[model samples]
Target: MKLSAETLADLHPEISRPAYDRSKVTAGILHVGLGNFHRAHQAIYIDDLLARGGSEEWGILGAGVMPADAQMRDGLKAQDCLYTVLEQDASGDKGRVIGSMTDFAPVSPNHEGILRAMASPSIRIVSLTVTEGGYFVSAETGGFNPDHPAIQADIANPGKPGTIFGAIVEGLRARREAGMVPFTVMSCDNVPHNGEVTRAAVLGIARGQDASLADWIDDKVAFPNGMVDRITPATTEARINHLREAFGLEDARPVFCEPFRQWVLEDKFTDGRPALEEVGVQFVPDVTPYEHMKIRILNGGHAMIAYPGALLGLTYAHDAMAHPLVRGFLEKVETTEVIPIVPPVPDTSLTAYFELIEERFANPRVEDTLSRLCLDGSNRQPKFIVPSAADCLKAGRSIDGLALASALWCRYCFGEGEHHEEIPPNDPSWDRLKEASRVARDNPAAWLQMSDIYGDVGQSPLFREGFTKALNALWENGTEATLQAYLND
Candidate 1:
């Protein structure tokens, strides 16, 4: 049977459906970029809160700004804004149909419906999961860059704004003009200090329109930083087939994710929020400690493994973890290098946290692609990999392993895997990166010379020395021999 509101009751007995009255649920939160992570993580939290029997008015209204989002919008509209989340681990595989999203607005060219939904008085919170690079903040300075091409376009045509921040600015302007309390702008992306980055993006656009609007948004609107975790791979045909074969249900774009999900948000909501705490959300006064730990350890760990595994033609993350050389390289980097720079988290052991992360990476059920981790190197390296190098250099520690990770990235960017397999362009700046990699083949320092991407990390003698040596070794010895060399060193 097709998965929809009408057929949900006939699903497998073990499959859970929304127990709450979907008709009574109203849109109080408007979430942008409703991808698999949002569906598997934040939306599920809202679903759980409602299942506990309260916060009906806090239901979600999904919106999308990008042109590709139209397909997602159309897919959900076909199924009554309902989708199944297949949460799987070694012990179990459970499916739950999520209905917290009362409805999704069909995407329009100029974001007409999204603007209307954003300006609606009933929507008290606007959250975002538009990815780390989507924030338009300069990696060099963690602040909004008005100079971004999209922001530049939005500046030229403010009325028919082109970016999410532009739409957000206009929506907040409409709310302010109509004498309504402003909704909070919560950022659930993995960037460091995401809420603050969001605030900068909003005000940077708003100030270009009017200083008064900028001040109001800065003072009244709340942008709360948060840490969100889940291992959700890009949807695959096998997953879609799994749903049909296992549950006897037909659905488009059903999410397949690891059972582990976590959200640590600071309690800086504007009007109100759901009873998310009851559903295992950690609401704290400060999310900094938690953010640093997860970013450096988990996110950084992914980056550390991504390139080397990609070079070796590994398909999935678990397969990479299973490789002895790759697994050993990750362990050495974390235990000796990455964890030392990470700040202490409250009531959490960093060593034990790393152990858990290793186990999570080793979970055979999650088919997280190494290429997924290898995507967006230009944005991810500075955020995930380079920062650790900077921290190690700042503390007068070794950056040998982190530099090897950097070397692997440069090698991976050369547009070929081992056995001469074509590694298609992955990053947004792939062309430039590939050319730099070719040049760095002879002059290895040329890769780190990208000041915009590497900044000060590229300038340090220790990092340059280590990166050049490791990158040189990889080019000559290949990934397997290169990793063994590093591990043996």
Candidate 2:
């Protein structure tokens, strides 16, 4: 049967809340980019709070600013805004029906609805999961790009919004006009200083439209930096079938994720937020150290493995980790190069962190695909890997392993090999990157010249020499031999 409150109550007899009454206890918390990660992490936490008779203050009001999110909006609306989240880990898999999302404002076309929702006093916390790219940042300057066509369009037609930042600014403007308190903007993406980044994006657009409003937002709004981690892979038909068979429910948008979930936020919310702290959320004075640690270690390690594994024709992260060379590369690069550069992580040992990462990678049940990690290499590498390489270089240390990792990326971007497996198009700049790599093999200097993508790494003699060497070896000797050489070194 299709999943609903009654169906859920019947399937999970022990749940204390009657399925029908679950919707009545929700309050509005506007959520952008209603993707799998938000559904699994934040929605689940709020659902747990409601389950304990603790919250009627934080129900998610789902909003989607992109065309891709239209499907999610339709699926959630079909099920009364309720869906299942299946947690898969090494231990096993368990399904929980999440009911914390109350309503949907399809923002792809209905820009007015989004602005109204955000301005609503009921929406005390405006949370986002709009991946790193959505911020429209100039990767070179690490700042907002006002010259972007989308930003230009949004600024030109402020009343009819086209971007999330535009929508946020319009909402904040309305709140100010109506004499209402400003909403707290919480970023749940994996980018560093996500809150500050978002604030810049929002305020950057607002300043172009109205400088006074921008100043008002700067003074009144709370953009809490956050560290959010959960490995929720994109859902497929096979997963839907698995959920149906496992739980006797035909939920179309059931989320599948690893059992691990973590959220660390800077404690700054203005309009009163969820008692999420009561249900295991970590509210800290500063999220920078934790952010750096996770971004560099966990996310950076994923990038380190993705390209190398993909070129070697390995499909999943665990499978890649199972290979001795891939595992060793991960260990050497992470422990030797990556971790030393990162500031201390809170309350935990780096050894233990690496151990946990290895275990997570080895969880075959999650099937974290290498290609998933490999997507948008141009965007991912600068944030995830290049900084570590830079830090090591500044310290007069070797990043030979890191360089090899990057060379593997350059090879992967070539998009073809003897196997003839077509690399799926994932990057907005894929065509340019592919063409650039083709020329780069003959003249490594040509590739590094793309200042937009590679930044200082492109021009660095260290990166150039290391990249040229690694690329040449991999091209001439193949993945296994290149790996062996790196390992022996």
RMSD of 1: 1.0
TM-score of 1: 0.99
Per-residue lDDT tens digits for candidate 1, residues 71-142, read 999999899999999988898789999999998876876788878997788999999999888989776665
Report the poorest 10 consecutive residues by lDDT, candidate 1. 135-144
Please give the lDDT score for candidate 1: 0.90
Per-candidate TM-score against the hidden true structure:
0.99, 0.96
- All models: lDDT? 0.90, 0.82
Q: Residue 59 in candidate 2 has what lDDT?
A: 81
